[model samples]
Target: MPERSLAAPKPALIEKVLMRCAGQCAVCRAWSHQTICESCLGLYARPLPRCWTCAARLPPAFVGRPRPQCGRCLQTAPPLDRAVAALDYRFPWDGLLQHFKYHQALDLRESLLERLNTALSAAEVEAPDWLLPVPLSIERLRERGYNQSHELAKALARRRGLRCKPEMLLRVRHNDRQAGLKLEDRAANVRGVFAVEPLLAARLRGTSVALLDDVMTSGSTLFELAGVLLQAGVMSVQAWVIARTPEPGDE
Candidate 1:
């Protein structure tokens, strides 16, 4: 008898299994078929006006502008041409992201990715030529066992039918985590830390690209990464974050 070849499980089947295994909503703890119950999502992730370049929540006064943007972004533009955030990094999402990013609870990925997909659709975000996840340094990758942003980017690429380039950008230097750093110091921590992969640099020229990340806090990392891509000659860079950290006193 010949040995049989093994086939991989379907993505839909895998997602279904993960959803069922969640058993309850991560936010409200309500028993639900999905990882996050719809009610909790509705209450917490309500769409809000945000800066087109930075994804910062826009004040009511700024609403209805032809192109909405916060004062900071207007005075000095960010490296991103456009930005879209699925939710705010507050309360339930902040805690949930900690678990998803630090605890190896990858089952949350399906729910998270779906939220981002929905936001992008609602925002009418154009599909870029390539989707690039901010790269993690070799040492960090060894410790974390995975790059959460890469996971999110790959899923988004599959859903949107764009090329996913996980290694196109390299974290040439490993720096301290941005969480503990002061807002003023965060930019310094990430400056000159990212570079485009030399062999792929030529291909990126004059192409539109999107940077996918699990969260954007202070925009330091994304800004630095975007600047590098722009310097590498990409025509445009968009920031797509699952969550954005609101500034102090921001609703």
Candidate 2:
């Protein structure tokens, strides 16, 4: 009898199934096995038109004015020359951000970075001379064992071929969390909390810098840090945040 040929081995059924649904999407509960499914992202994660100065959401009909600024920013300018956010700090993003910052899910860093990268591209933001993380206070750094903003800045800088300056901003003291604070009081909490690193100070002179942060609740923290950068003679300051808190009920 002719030698029988062996059939090619088949992949395990369970393996196929696992590969089919790697993880469920957090927002829509779809079996995309990704951080978020395309449908959910298409529906909820679409970027909003933002105010040029503060990065707050603006209406689609809005057109940037003589300077491409919103009413609030036009009335009282932000320290940032420009600012933008990836998401509206709502639903799935709020949860994802909490995971990135407060929880130990370090894997979320890559997902968040990917989202931020996509946003930067979609917004067509300009590259800056320096990319910097909003620094954590020493106590917070020791407790967390990682600075989310610094990690983000480094990764983003690589994508844009910019220099990541993690040491550019120093948070001198830990302030109460801004999560629940009223807008008026938030500024007071973060005021005088940031100072530029003296040795690295000279590098910022006459150079445009972009600040990276996980979230922007109020403008206080970024503003405070930008003030110091401006004092050090930074030509311009811009901010890129993963999420921006929407007005109450705007969620």
Candidate 3:
């Protein structure tokens, strides 16, 4: 009789072991059941005063204000009615986001979503009528294998028991990269790039929506999309981003 080969461990069992064992925190290298660990989250991701419209970090003096608005936003409001960010685009978060966005580090999604959800809860943000992710163009979607914003929106909708309308917004055209571009140029870069799905446009009429994205730099992309949504009769548009870029030279 031929000897039988030893059975290999199942993928589910290996996943279970990984979940049970403590792993190194991405920030402090501390052993933890979480990716970023609770301590690091407390220190690095503590809520701070942010602009009501753009989610920019406000001066410490504005800490207790009911609605903190940054000076830039005060001069001219952004398209978004409100915006909230889970973390700043800096340090360890920048690196981690890069890995998640470009290298397919899908495991980081849970911890990232946890931080965003906690921030949203603490902010006492009202649930919108729908959660819509800023869509990617066909070429980019094929290249990336996933829409990061859609993934975030789906996870957030699940946590909040809200509707996620991924198909409601569509990226109709490819735009130049906004990095290193001036604010006006960035705005121009994204203009006319987004449109609402004709079939579903009526459902969005007079309904508020929250847009989910991984990061906001100049925020041109989100603002542009918000304008399109508003034109399609969306009552209000709010942005929920995983991170916001700090002001220039603002350590």
C-alpha local distance difference test of each model: 0.90, 0.81, 0.87
Best by lDDT: 1
Off by over 4 Å in 2: 1-21, 63-67
The better-scoring model by TM-score among 1 and 3 is 1
Candidate achieving higher lDDT, 2 or 3: 3
lDDT by residue (tens digit), candidate 3, 37-146: 88988888888789989999887898889878988889988988899998999888999998888777767787888889988988889899999998999988888888
As for lDDT, the candidate ahead, 1 or 2, is 1
TM-score of 2: 0.86
- RMSD in angstroms between candidate 2 and the native structure over all alpha carbons: 7.5
lDDT of 1 by residue, 1-251 (tens): 99999899986578768787647888888988888899998898788788999999988777666669888898998999999999999988898888988887777898889888988998898889999998999998898889999988887888889999887899998899999899999999999999999998999999999999999988999999999999999999999999999978896
Candidate 1 overall lDDT versus native: 0.90
Model 3 lDDT at residue 113: 89
Candidate 2, residue 154: lDDT: 79
Residue range 16-75, candidate 2, lDDT tens digits: 354456787766777776667779888878867788788888767774433366677778
Q: Looking at model 2, report the run of 10 residues with the lowest lDDT sum.
A: 10-19
